[model samples]
Target chain A: MARMSTPPRGRPGRPVDPEIDSRVLSAALEVYSEVGWAGFTMNAVARRGGVGKAALYRRWPTRQDLFAAAINSLRTSGPVEITGSLYRDLTQTANRLINRFLGPHGMASIRALVDAKIYPDELGEALDYVRQSTIIGGRKIVLAAVDSGELPPDVSPSLIMDALAGTLVHRILLIPDTRRAQLAANPEPLVAQVVDLVLRGVGWQGTVSTRRTESGSGEPRTASEG
Target chain B: MARMSTPPRGRPGRPVDPEIDSRVLSAALEVYSEVGWAGFTMNAVARRGGVGKAALYRRWPTRQDLFAAAINSLRTSGPVEITGSLYRDLTQTANRLINRFLGPHGMASIRALVDAKIYPDELGEALDYVRQSTIIGGRKIVLAAVDSGELPPDVSPSLIMDALAGTLVHRILLIPDTRRAQLAANPEPLVAQVVDLVLRGVGWQGTVSTRRTESGSGEPRTASEG
Candidate 1:
């Protein structure tokens, strides 16, 4: 908290190796997603990534730094694109949210959100980006829909985002690890159900054709398609 | 997994002390919820509860056993009672879900669900009760509603349950600890918004009077009441 500015990455270490850095970053996420912050330790990351304690410490001085860097590394994937059509935009957003949670470090994000409640002071700046964005990430989607008159001006964007993210998280939490692969293989059905329900729940006035075009199935599919 | 039937409580040890047993159980939930399973240890529980290792082990021989006992202790509150009306039933259900998650042992339950994925075999039968119930708990509500023709016959109960549970969990996960008291002070507003949105989304054909009776507010308040 005392530091006024963000420190340069790999500052203390003697010019870090990209190969080792990449390995350590992946290892950090894997460890976090598996054991959570309570069980997260430098030793575990070192042992898992096959790197020495000294190397791991030098490259990233603190546990928070290492975890933050690992989280920031995922920044390349970027935010959900705002694709004009409210129905498609949410479907794509829901898909992105679900796919991300099921991704390699997806479990880490889910665990982090819960852990943040327990350990409020633990996360550093870079790590805070995902935590902060995830809650308000759908603001853009809501704004676009409201401006375009697809959704009511009074709709709570957070509710819609949570309904999507939380439903997927709940679904994922319920699915046994053994079946995750099968769900991952066919995410469309899950996405379809969630997106369609959310759209109707929020009273989206978007075109009917555009709504079903992306959503593979919903209760009204046969009637609408006919 | 190999057990033929549920084992008796205090089976391994001689009769246990109710005083120490209660302390140890509470301590186990605190430790698990605070640090999760990764950092969960008998020593921590012993220290937190101010009980000796010998006393802690006498009642619950294994870590899983101790944690299972701690989780099972919460069964005293019993399941959510089913009210006949769909609107009131869901509203009550949502409140119960939110209130439980906000309770002392609530965090432990949430954390355990995620950890179950990482350590599936670690959960003993007793502990598995909460996890199984949470996913399928709202079936009774759906059955009653469908029977009464309040909800469409084909409405997916799991979806409704997940949406309510997941949305509230998502909301709780976002609120900072500092603001939890403010949110907890009055949960009625949150319940109203979520229930109303979900009711509309699911195409509830229930009478307007009953739907808004429990829900304090929604966007359609003016038009409906008029």
Candidate 2:
């Protein structure tokens, strides 16, 4: 029995501890939010995570490696399964996207990532991975809608992704005081309006769900006129 | 006896020498492009401009002041005259935008500006001014279309601005080898498509002028179906 002690490395499922990995990653984000990318270091991350420097080093050989792993950990469950019409799916996804941006971490994290791109190669690679992974789930939902004929087949993924995310990011970066409550207050109506606008632009044949009123004049919106 | 002497400020309506100021600004952009914002200095700019350091100091009090001056010198023009239709006006403007980006200074200046924002307060202020100036003309063109019943009045101006400019920026930033040629190659069709998409989203009542296909699918589009 004394001779039967097995090393942790030899076990099939013990390659890396998922729980410790998540802790390390979250700690990295915490440090980033405090000191920004320039100030972030592997040593600071280890201190934040309450892990030994050696353990942190064993997992992530470089700062970018740690950052990219941290980003992967932040990614939530996929496909935004809201069952209904195309409008419903788009509206739900848009709301989720806005909410995620408005969360506790907020847009500073994103700005930090963009700022990081100005430096060495690892940061660029890590930022790209973070950006792409963040967008991939939303894209999957849009693609799913297209497959079901909820959206036009020829509509571009790139255009939609850029427009929606870019507009949100612009708001976050320029206006420092915006809060999650403000963002979520009436997102449904705006989301509904945008979804209709985009669906129509993409050449979908459907009833325009959100009728818009003229600016200043606030003209009455009547779908029957069109 | 009073000695008749031209004031040290120089001739009226030409108080300062344009040649030196212009030279300094141009040289600053050159240095910024090569060494980036962190390395750019007033002394280096003065040397590049072939002006005495004292003259440069006399004009610009600080690095920020010089950077702001240089950014302010960049030219931006027009609420491009509408061509009786949204399609023509939008496509014409898009082409002009592409030309500005692809021209002599082109993308390097933009990259410098983007990099600048990460560091200094002066750069941030300069960026704000530049961003506002760049979008003003475009906004006016879109507003004109709205007045002409080409787009819905309810569309958020800021959101629209972000979408148009941000889409272009995102493409340039994310894609490794994106070129102005790639954008301008079939500028007319792409612009027309985006215009139609925007118009439809905004609840504009107009005839679809072109039969453009969706990106992945080759099917010709008809407004009636949309």
Candidate 3:
């Protein structure tokens, strides 16, 4: 049994050919987006990539390997680079997260992975890769903000990240009318709104003096001085 | 084609059997939690519910019908009663939302629905049921808080509700370690944390008389407090 099952073979190399792997990854994304994870398979991916099954298998011996490679490729696709401003940094990150989920590749792969999470170890590593690289990247940006003094150090970065992302996800998943572009259009407004709410809720010692126009409309003044 | 379709044989005005439908919903929940949404089917639900497939079909007619009925049951599970205090009311709402997601029925259903949302229509309705019910209940609580003066009168209840629930969902989905029991152990601390954060973020004008303690010893004073 051991000999017959002896390690499935695949291509081995240092600087592996990006062209073949990239083609496979993109094709895998296409197939997943079209049919979702439950419908996705290596065979389909191979067909989509227009490569021989043997060649695809040689590169990724298991389904998990293929998925991992795809997620890794996605990570590289729009790796967030910080510009040191929390507002700008977060706005950009939110846009990226929303864009990915709304796109064909991101939506399909996400659907597939979520479907597979219930049966542990079947697609566990790939699921982990997806969560950490994308979802957790959202967390990291919040953490970076906290580390800087942009946010009050007292608040939990994880919770804030969850709240913001959750609201977006909740809207996407539930509200049929809400599109990705709508979310992207004003990501900063919601971010700013929540950040302010949370900071005040936490009793952040920072005093926010308001400078409102005397429009007499009685809107709570914007921060006169941060 | 018209004659080929089976007509409803049940007598008119016959009350639907609640007991059988309830049993099926329970069974569906169990199977979906164990096997996931993709693998769940009416036949499987029938087997687990201990009813004849014919009996299930007589009531639900299709997988979509069954899923929809089960989700509707979840919607009417309970309501968050308004207490006279803002803090207490908001805290209770948060607690309920957290409990629902972290609780056995709520979590499993949410997990299944998240998996199902990738597909169109049938599962989408089930997912939407979960999402909409929570948001509705959440908005009610926020409105009560505003009326009771716990929150500022001008505070946007929808935004607050979305942020509050969204934050909790994020924790449940991404940070698996935050369990129902932990929330139960001391929801007040988390509530206090969230409320404080949110209130501040909203720019709610209030006197900051209480000195909220920091969780750890890391230069305790915020820049503005002193």
Q: Order of all candidates by lDDT, from best down to worst?
A: 1, 3, 2
In terms of lDDT, the poorest run of 10 residues in model 3 chain A is A1-10
Instruction: List CA RMSD, all candidates.
Output: 8.1, 12.7, 11.7
| Candidate 2 chain A minimal-lDDT segment of 10 residues | A2-11
The residue-level lDDT of candidate 3 at B155 comes to 64
* Residue-by-residue lDDT tens digits, candidate 1, B1-226: 2231233234575545788778888999999888877788889999999988998777778888887777766645555666657888888888887888888777777777777766777763544566556544577677666666677767777778778888889888876666789878899998988898788878888964543234322222111100
lDDT per residue for candidate 1 within A93-212, as digits (tens), equals: 777778777888777776777777777788534444664566555888788789878899999998898888888888787765667899899999878888877888899898744433
Worst 10 residues of 1 chain B by lDDT: B217-226
Docking class of 2: incorrect
Which prediction has more favorable TM-score, 1 or 2? 1
The runs of at least 3 residues in candidate 2 whose Cα sits more than 4 Å from the true structure, single-residue gaps closed, are A1-59, A70-74, A77-79, A82-84, A100-124, A131-139, A171-190, A206-226, B1-56, B73-75, B78-84, B96-128, B152-155, B176-189, B207-226
DockQ of 1: 0.50
Chain B TM-score in candidate 1, rounded to 2 decimals?
Answer: 0.81
Off by over 4 Å in 1: A1-16, A124-127, A208-226, B1-16, B124-127, B208-226
Best TM-score among the predictions, by candidate number: 1
DockQ of 3: 0.29
Q: How good is the docking of model 3, by CAPRI class?
A: acceptable
Every prediction's TM-score for the first chain?
Answer: 0.80, 0.67, 0.67
